[model samples]
Target chain A: MMKRGSGFALSIMLLSALTLSACSNGEGAADGGGKKQTINFVHWRGEDTETFNSIISKFEQENPSINVDMTVFSSGDPYNNGLQAMLLSGEGADVFVSTPGSLFSTLLKSNAFEDLSGTPLLNSFSPDLIKSGQSDGKQYAIPYQLVYNVPVYNKTMLDKLGIQPPKDWDGFLAMCQKLKDEGITPILYGYDVSPGQLINTLVMNLMPEDDSFNKFQTGEVKATDPWFAEALTRFKELVDKGYILKNASGTKYEGALSLFAQQKGAILASGSYSMATIAKQNPAIELGLLAPITTSGSDAKYEGVHTTTFMLAVNAKSKHKEAAVQFAEFLAKPDIAAEYANATGQLLTVKDVKYDSKELIIQSEWMSKKTVFQPRLINTNKKIETALNESLNMIVGGASVEKTISTTQAEIDRNLTK
Target chain B: MKTRNGTLWLFIIPGLILYSFFFIIPAVSSLLLSLTNWDGMTYQFDWVGLKHYGDLARDPVFGKALGNNVKFSLTVIIFQFGLSLFFAILVMKNTKLNVVYRTIFFFPTVVSSVSIGFIWMFVYDPNIGSLNLLLNSLGLESLARSWLGEPSLAIYSIAFVQFWGHTGQVMIIFIAGLQSIPKDLYEVANIEGASRWNAFRYVTWPLLAPSATIVLAYTTIQSFKSFDLIIAMTDGGPNYASEILSTFMYHQAFTYFSFGYATAAAVVLMLIIMVVTYFQFRLLKADRVVY
Candidate 1:
């Protein structure tokens, strides 16, 4: 009985080893035979995975020798965390998608991305948008889309209420008041995620000519500068007047978008990305884009345009660099850019890529005219952004605005020293 | 005897290799990393010994997170242990219905915490959520507020979900302990004219001490290491009100790229759980009550 048991155990062990070897051999065969070179592409566009897959298929069709293996992560911090780990371990994707911001800047500084300078693909994009993806005059990323952060008004509601889109801050306030009097929620703002966006737009509109924000970056000016304080005061006035939603603090980004789509609110202060979602939800709802309303009594117009929406970059340490570069080059073609814009509701930055979406057309008009490419806080220190976002929320929660600003400024100064 | 010892070592080596590779090595490396100023993205890092700890000391948000973690741990232990113990006692008898009841009670534990968090988020959502809708339907409209948005209530709301998710495991453990107690102990007590209260106090309580310790230790560790549910439900927000140590560590490591600081936070959490678990074992250690 003991010998039979031992024989059974031996057979099992031999079987297990054989199975493991077979599996490894199968993997080796798949990787190292007459197959196409596989280049992994990771991106954080969970919503646009279908669009990305379609693009990948087209790219593969054009370049038959290269296969693109795509992985999609949910956007925001989860994607950032996963990408950081992958890069540190030298197992990062051959090609990855990133926005041209502080995270990208940090990765670029660390030499995580391949220098794509002198590539013919770089010449296709507008010079300014290309410059946005560069660090120290070396191109590290290529832009995929142009996004504009401006207030989107419900044109159907506005026409029904006989309120034209406002051109100035006073007119904006008057319109909000009229909406409130008509028992309509004036604005749908999700302060839970980053209250700073709303405050930043206000500051940009109020202090367009003032370069004092740059002073705060250099420690030459405090966050409690009168311009910033005045902006906060105006925001507070809006909150006190109930022009902003009552439960704005509790509402999430998607929740606010849903509310806007349901016509519960007359206006949504969001980026161009929200247009596709809102349109998908309520196709009949007419949407109109407005430039940032001027806070000064003068008639000054400014549009907060974002140049780098989604950018593709090659990993410097990738084993399949040639294949990755080929895929990236293919993505930069004007036809592919137009197809990408059609698939995903983002505007292309390539010179000759003509796409027709009403929202994109309006955003393009603003881009052609008076556009100040918004300085994303993601381009700044994470602590400073966190401090600004939290302090803005606290101010909205009835904390002393002056104290919040000074304290946040102090925090920023401390982070700078670190 | 020598051959037997060699065979035992052969059996143990693979497990030891895995443990060393997966746990001990990572833990030691994390301790070393905690003393540096690595931003995670950059290859270069400076040895800033205890500086992260100093920064953590000065960070009020870290303090708030630690406090939130402690509150969460305590709340989960109370609800999870109390309700689980009560249910375990209820179903300790080997009745046909008891199997069904136990299965029903343990169902939530089998589901992923992320799914539970998402399910609870929908229930807590202010506008179309069932919690608020139910309240409004019953003419309790004033009580219908955003449950996860409120700072004071958010931590408890997450703790309640944690409690709901894990109470079943605790119940199962307690049921095993209850089943192991011989029937004659209770019968002898009944023959001696002892009441159900007296029988339970003298016999069942002391016998269940070991199981209680196991449940407490497991639940405490789980509470301290809680991340996914909070991340999925709150993302530590409505302005950092529901932020816990794990979420804060994650933000520092990934969001802020402060890997060294995040590792320090992880070390502190590890030390806290170890100390708490040690004391728990000491206080609950009971002599064997063999029948």
Candidate 2:
């Protein structure tokens, strides 16, 4: 009874403290002209929150009438829960980050954004980027950054080995074989299983022949497609050949990246964004970007990706609708995009934009000249992604590709049906 | 009297409203959501009652996650409780500099979990981890491997971490429980010619039951909902060896937008927690423990 009483008392005290903090902050913000209007800006870039806040500072300067209250969810938890909870309560973020995933579409249908179809800033964005931001018949979100998935290799290692860059599947395998013979692990990948594992990079590389996502997304492809099976086989082969880091199934992204930076590994299955990070961490780390390896023989196709390009959406229930639009417009500006790219290691969709980010410059140049755009289709289910990631991790770690692929196909089919 | 009761009810109304809005409503709606095929964010979710649950039965990942969660919970219940009790007893022993020791021990508990997770990752670093590096410098090279990267060792490494991160909280609870126990019991046990183990087994153990119950509940929930540690440590990877239900749910819903499917997973996890807690509460018949 005493313990219970003490526990209750502690809770009450903590509650009071939280309430006090809330009231004081709320009061300080609200002490302005009549009833002050605050825009709740929600995002998941805490590692870059300072940069985000600087952007917010610019927004506030541009619109002196409004104060921006920010909500930052660490990229790990990613704020989706809090967002979902608030959204369901009809009181979510005023200006929020939107993805092409299910939640973004839900927010769109719920009328959680203002119609910005004919806005002045509309002409500033790329036609493809602007189109990617559409839902039904309205433009709700603004494409913020374009990210691509591909293989990155050690330039010094390949050069020292006197091997040309892998242009096709056979060339890639030959490179892998050469690296293996030289006692170097070919691809340093983190395959920790569960859903959404690093399989996306491998899968993208292996399935260049098929626009797998395009087919599955349009309801035009079977879950049991032969290409997916082929992708599975290729992933298993990478594992069987010891091309992947020996303990990749246990390694984390940070671990893998660190190893690659140390020159202990040859190839890293990473996105274009990583070039800048690699350079930042190790400036002298001679790196080269390659097209995601698909089909090793005569069928090799070096496809590019336009997926993971994030956008900002005005919350449907935002009170400061005009200000939110202003925020999106600001983020889309080439100059602002350049700054954001420098800060977040990404690129603006406008190819010609000279980003302050050297990483963005290198990646964008590589992308424009070669890679294919694999936009993450809006119709894809996250469970399917998870299943694919898990299945790929399993395959790479010596699990049966056939069973895992079939199971993944079944899950994808089931989720799509739902 | 009626006015006082009315005032109390009025005060409680806000709390009730908040509770229903934040907790009860979501819990109820989640049940409704589990019956549908909501992509989690899109407005177009079709009701597919029990379909997801049926599919979940065939999900190998679900089975793996479930088994892993149970194993984690059971380990946490044992090691965490055992370590906490040991520390609590040691601290409860009359000694000088107890405060300093207590503060030092609990230092980790007060720090943000993210910090601990990151620091521990460094400690377990295969090449540069201070732990392995120290061992190697001391000519113990064979003992070190990629602690976080090896599938066979990742889950245990992570579980041990959580055990370390949480031992202080559990210890404090145990300390509180031990202090609250009357010293007269020890004296009475001595007069009865009981050995220290016997006295501990009969007297101290029974009195610690309440603390045990609370500790078990906390660890059970924590282990079942293990995410931050796993995300920080292994992210259920190398090959999903360390994945628990929370990571699985987050990946399913947020990463892919399978809200209804994720909800089904969440519902299953919740049921498991409730059942385990219930069974434990019944097992202890906790009412038998006298203050």
Candidate 3:
């Protein structure tokens, strides 16, 4: 009888332990003492944590009725995966950052974010920038940072080779040939990383001015159109001509940057985000930016700019909706944007921010001039970008351009349900 | 006996409930989700029946990933098992040198797979890697090809790293099983004028069957579930040439936001693992072996 009683007690204890383990403490719940409401904010920029915290502190000082609990993920797929799980489980942050791509599209489609069309913050950003984050004519996210992708050449190397920065396709090809003849790698681009950038550059340069590429995204036209085929063929010609690095398919993005910094490569086809890192690696090297050259003999030059690099949105289901919106508004303030840009060396979409770095000034000047905004298709369909990247990789591996384009087109068509 | 049985049931009920809540329920839910057209973030989902499975059947990327997984499993079985058994046999006896060798061999097992992947990435780097430097120093420059970059060699390169990281664990299991074998059996074989090879072939081989089964099952499952190492090293890249099913499913679910399709891929992977493990149990069953 005693043993039986003991067994019953033990079972009860085990069950209690299991139950206790399943329970959470609810740390962020509203306090009954009438303290400031806590607004949970999550972002995938661990590199900007310190700067972001300082900005948050300033906001908290201004708005004493609100407290922000910020969580920073270390970036890449893990952040996206975790954010997806949290949003699905109805436990996501009140305010979160999203890229204006597949993730933003998913959030907008699900109505996960509050409609910010009437928000005062919306008026601060340009309509062109704000429209990129809208779905079905409703604003969902506010612009934060701007990133521009262009051809960065080593000014010192170009001067030594007696070649100026190219503005057209013939000059670009001639510079590449000259560099290659001098036993230098002409282009330091990694196919494994940021493969879509070069493809975007080529498409922007080669596509007909009729905006057929945009129409293709809406399913009005196919990717196997003559314009796309021509772009693929031209890209393959560069690969076949050995203008791109011999082991580019294998080279990583960081590896290519290191090569450029070491003066092993004359030109790096990358974005403004790399400027800070490049300067840190080789401060002595002078860098110059040029628009991606056109092969169609068109006199017009086109530079690609990403107006919405990382934007903040308010969660529709957040309990502290007012506080979350206030925090987002604080982030869009011009002073905060300037402080963020100064601390992180990133370009902001906020109006009238001062640039201390000459490199940023040069990039901003290019941005203020002739530029083609990145297409909505590249942002909307991640599968298309991945397919294009993989196709480029295969082309570098000696696959035929026609087969690569067809396979990529098929992949895109199959995955275009959205 | 009835009271004892009741106590046993009481003890097991808590574990059973936890398992049902965490594992079985989620797994069954995922199976149900596989038939839907959910993008994970959306509130609305449509039941699409077996459409996702149909798509998987036609997916060339899925085919490539499965083939890579099979190759990865086979290579892990051969190299991890073979090297571990050899090392176990070498160090089974209690000796100082053997202890040192055991410690050295087992060191990598303590390191996380992410760290191991990063280490191997540097080792396989084409320009500045130690492997290429060694090849150049040995006057074998022609043999110094990109290890993780080439389409044909990337999977094998990753497999070698997996083998290096896990062989120590298998060796330790083999050592435990070796120690459990009765010394009298070896004495008896020697008394009968049997050679060392004969003794090992007849006695050690049969006794180690259980250990080999454990090692094989573990290595097989590990090979199929490989993600972090591949992600950290090549990210299943060089044109998805080295993409396994886990990475493919990850891209679908996280990158493409196709939760339904990703779950279908998960279900297929689970079925593959179940079928393979079932066969392994049958083939390596110890019931027929005599002590």
Candidate 4:
């Protein structure tokens, strides 16, 4: 009887240990004070690590009872996969950042983020900027940064070469020709995310509707449409003119940025978010924002493309939801947002935040100008987005516009659910 | 005896439970999940029942990726095996210089795949790459081209990297096999006035067949597992010219969020590996000799 009882006790002990191990979130441990808690935060913005750490330090100072532990993944698929695995297993994070569109949709479908619609944090952001993080009329995340998703040009180079920023399609072509004639590559392009950004900048003034990417999903519009084909043709023309680098499609993001910083190219076909990095690479580079004018007329609808991305959200399964919310609310505060904007060279969605960075100050004037949302991020289906992005790469690699459009349209057609 | 049995079970119980929960259960779940129209994150999904398999059959990118994998595996296996064996034989003698050479060759295998990928990407970079730069310096400027950017050359370029990275590691296996061959066999061949080629063909080659089998199977799997290197270098691009089955499945599952489709592709990959390995063992089993 004694032996049997001891065995039973051992079994119970083993089960208890297993349960204890499973219950721990690994990092979010509470100390003696019941109010004290740690919140795990994860994001993909490794470049903003220092700035975010400063912000978190400030938040922790104000709320001494809460500690924020942050984890950053290298941007792109690595972050997506890491976050998805964690959220699926209900471990590792309490607060996280998300991008708009397909990733946001995935997070929402998983019921991963707590709805921020009724929260006071929602009131602090611009309503127009907040809409990108919304789905089915529910605000699941708060977009923190407002960025012009267009090419950032070297103002110093253009000034020295006596070139003006083009306002129309023909002017843009002429500008490229002139840059090429002056023994300069007109554009520096990267292989990874530049193709999508280039296509987005090109189609912003040309796309018939603001939500045409979604319209493609519904079969209301198609990739084979004349607008998209024109975008491809224009992209191809730049390649044919030898204005794009001979090995543009082979260049990585950092390589292109470095080349552009060295004055190898007049324009870097990445967005305004890259301003800080470009400055870091070459502080002497005088930067200006240029959106490709696809239309010939001065009555072009949008001056550039803008997106409210780098969305922040409280994880739904967070044990310290109040602390997570508190930290988010701290970020929404005007002074803090202003500090973030100035330090990171980013424009924030927070109302009445002051900009101090020279680049931010210059680009801030374009905020009031007519700017469309990043059309690429409007699609809920990522497969369609990937196909469209690949279409741009295909055109860059010398594929015919007809084949590119048909292939993309077929992908869109097959992916349509509605 | 009873006490020994009880102790044995005590050791086995923990590992059995872990194996069941971690490997066996997840693998079975993955197999089942392949039948459903699951989007990975969403909880609710309908049973689709082999529809993903049918879709994969008709998918051109999947076909292209499979073809690339085949081409990649064949190229890596042939070149990696032949070169490793040749180097192994040359350095098989237990001399100080040979040891140094062996260590030098095996050094790359110890480095992480990501670092190797990054290093090779720089080497293959069209403008600033060492290859093109070297060609230009040698007055061969016309021969210099985008090594990774060209679709026709991308997969072969990646395959060469795989071969370069693993040849030394595989060479170690052949070296071990060479050392195991009885010195008397070579003496007998020499006494019979056997030519160098004839001795190697009869003695070293036959004795090395088992190691060759291991090298072949390992290189095959390593080629398939070149997902990280490919992702870092070309990301299965210029177009899908460099994509293999593993990268294709990763894009489908993680990038496109099509868990069901990706799982189906994974199942196909598993079956392919199993059948190929089976054939490898069978083909080699005939030549394997026991002392």
Top candidate by lDDT: 4
List DockQ for all candidates. Answer: 0.51, 0.31, 0.57, 0.63
lDDT of 2 by residue, A123-197 (tens): 777777656677677787776677666667788888998988866667778889999998888888755321242
| DockQ, structure candidate 3 | 0.57
Candidate number with the higher DockQ (2 or 4) = 4
The pairs that clash in candidate 1 are none
Give the whole-model CA lDDT for all candidates, comma-separated: 0.79, 0.72, 0.80, 0.86
TM-score of each: 0.92, 0.81, 0.93, 0.94
Ranking by lDDT: 4, 3, 1, 2
The residue pairs in collision within model 4 are: none
lDDT per residue for candidate 4 within A28-126, as digits (tens), equals 334544456778889888877898899999998888778888999877778888887878777677889988988988888889989877888888998
Quick one: best DockQ, which candidate? 4
Residue-wise C-alpha lDDT for candidate 1, range B184-209, written one tens digit per residue: 99999999999999998889988988
lDDT of 3 at B254: 84
lDDT of 4 at B265: 90
- Native contacts matched by each model: 0.46, 0.44, 0.58, 0.58
Please report how far candidate 2 places residue A377 from its true position, in Å.
4.3
True contacts kept of 4: 0.58
**Alpha-carbon runs more than 4 Å astray in model 4:** A1-32, B1-23
lDDT of 1 by residue, A166-222 (tens): 767888889999999998888777765436456556766666454445455557666
